[model samples]
Target: MIQKIPPGPVTMSDWNFVIVEYQGHVVEKFLGYYYELQHIRFSSQVIEYDPQSNTGKTWSGSKYFFLDRPGPLYPLAQIYLAHFSRNEGIRVRLKYQG
Candidate 1:
């Protein structure tokens, strides 16, 4: 089934999949929404963001992750695979709902 992103910053239950270049491979990570803030925590790094701005970045271990958080003010990211795609990478198609 498809998931819908709310028309604003995710509350305390929204989730978005993130793709990162880690260890010479593209890894897909699932980030959970908690508190009134938007933060994605990796193994040793935490990407913080302002819901209004919808953007975040963090450097963890030997990898760095930067993303434009999907929400109301911005377009949502379409996850091709919920799991890590080492070959396909992160495939996302933008669709306009009008």
Candidate 2:
């Protein structure tokens, strides 16, 4: 389901209620307070979005990884609001079993 995030801060509690479903299956199930957003960076080819072509181009540089965020999991959602604010080209999707 595509959800629109309202303007304002998104608390951890709000993230807990967000169930990331893809292909009619639950992919990311938040674990209340236990779930945390982790960020990482490494040397790699950077991929930038080309709005004109609606495609990505890889450039030489360090790559940054923002993990456990909503934008990557739900790309259709508006990113200017709350947890959907990340505009980075790189992201990591992790399934927490804890």
lDDT of each: 0.36, 0.27
lDDT tens digits by residue: candidate 2, 1-98: 33332222112221122334444554222212211232111112224533343222223332122223322323222232234324343233333211
lDDT of 1 by residue, 3-97 (tens): 43322333333334455564565544435443343442222233454456544343342222224344312222223323324356344221212
Q: Which pairs of residues have clashing backbones in candidate 1?
A: none
Q: Give the best candidate by TM-score.
A: 1
Candidate 2 error regions (>4 Å): 1-5, 13-21, 24-94
Model 2 / residue 69 / CA error / Å: 12
lDDT of 2 at 70: 24
**Model 1 lDDT-worst window of ten:** 72-81
